[model samples]
Target: MKQTLVIGASLNPSRYSNLAIHRLVQNNIEVKAIGLREGVVTDITIVTDKINFKDIHTITLYLNAKRQVDYYDYIISLQPKRVIFNPGTENPELYKILDENKIHYEQACTLVLLGTNQY
Candidate 1:
């Protein structure tokens, strides 16, 4: 399993980001998270700021296009194998940026991918 980073993570259990975190852990994948507020989920701590995560194979986004604007450079800096634009987080601008940098990405649902054994 790829080591993943869940961006725009939420502390609320009902949110998909939260569920993804739990699912990723259940599947025995290394997972890190970044959210507005600091918190914990299934032994994973959600940080409030970027920390230059290393060897991140996948970055699954939970934020909308607008919120993602600020993360463009930060995401590229991490140099993940690919970025997953989950549902509403899809952004054409970011896609272009990633493409220019030679980073792979896909607009898909993280939960669905996980459920279907595709993640």
Candidate 2:
């Protein structure tokens, strides 16, 4: 299982980000949830500090494209092999940057991919 980092994770069960975290765990994928707020998801701590991230294979975003500018550098620094845009997160500028850095990415829903066994 690839270690996935869920950016913009939330504790609120109503949120899609939280549902994605649950789905990620259900699929047996190792996950590290990161968000500005602090809370737990799937019995795992939602990390806030960027310094704690390592060995990340994928980064599935839950944040909107407009809120992503500040994270461009931090995300690139993590150097994940791929980053999934996850529905409303699609950003052309970020995609361009990811391409330039040779990082693979896709604009799709993580839950759908997992459910369809295409993740």
TM-score of each: 0.98, 0.95
lDDT of 1 by residue, 32-81 (tens): 99999999999999999998988999999999999999999999999999
Model 1: ten consecutive residues of lowest lDDT:
85-94
Over 7-96, each residue of candidate 2 has an lDDT whose tens digit, in order, gives 999989999889988998998999898888888887968978775588999999999999888889989999999999988898999999
Steric collisions counted per model? 0, 0
Question: Where does candidate 2 have its weakest 10-residue lDDT segment?
Answer: 44-53
Best by TM-score: 1
What pairs collide in candidate 2? none
TM-score of 2: 0.95
